[model samples]
Target: MNNQDIKAKETTKDSKYIQQHLANERTFLAWIRTAISIIGVGFLVTNLHFTMRSTLSPLGNQLATLIGLVSVAVGIVTIILSAAVYVKKIKDINNQTFRPPVISMIFLGVFIIIISLIFGAYFFII
Candidate 1:
């Protein structure tokens, strides 16, 4: 066979959707990074509260603790959901039936808003 013919055969052996798969993987990694950041902030906030406990009122300390715990829970949930999303996307890509996950996007948006409001209230209280 000619060089072009051999290369075409090799290309066919690889997935035609390689680019889409790569993009999906990148998106998964981004989600993981976001989860880690959320977890890190949770830990940081909790530690900061402990560090400054002497100056904090009882209610302020409790609120900080609650916020930190909630942050960690949200991060954990994000990790799980992102993994699920990654799996679903892989299936969708392979089937050539990809569609944006609108519900997940809406849930994430609402979650962020709620978290921001909680943070804002906590800061306002302190």
Candidate 2:
């Protein structure tokens, strides 16, 4: 094939794979949004301890700070891991070996549940 013909063929191949690439981009953006939200919540929780210290017991403030730090840490970890996963998914798509994303979803669900329990305890028990 001539150079122009080879370039046209490659473009066609890429066009056929565009949908998967777009889906990967969307997933990456969603993960970014999730990470930002988690970090924001962490900041809110952390500040609440200081703002409402008079009403909260000392132990309550401590618990809030701890939870906030953990949340922030998890958010950072999520961003790092998501970036890695995004890269892996793109590579897999290019190689036609993409796998279902089950483990990350399960981990996210459990993380949300645990965070919910922490917030419930903070509001009701502490």
Best candidate, lDDT? 1
Off by over 4 Å in 2: 1-9, 12-15
Alpha-carbon TM-score of each model against the true structure:
0.85, 0.85
Model 2 C-alpha lDDT per residue in residues 13-93, reported as the tens digit of each score: 446689998999899999899888988988898787778756888778877888889888988998999899998987898
The TM-score between candidate 1 and the true structure equals 0.85
Total clashing pairs for each candidate? 0, 0
Lowest lDDT sum, 10 consecutive residues, model 1, at 7-16
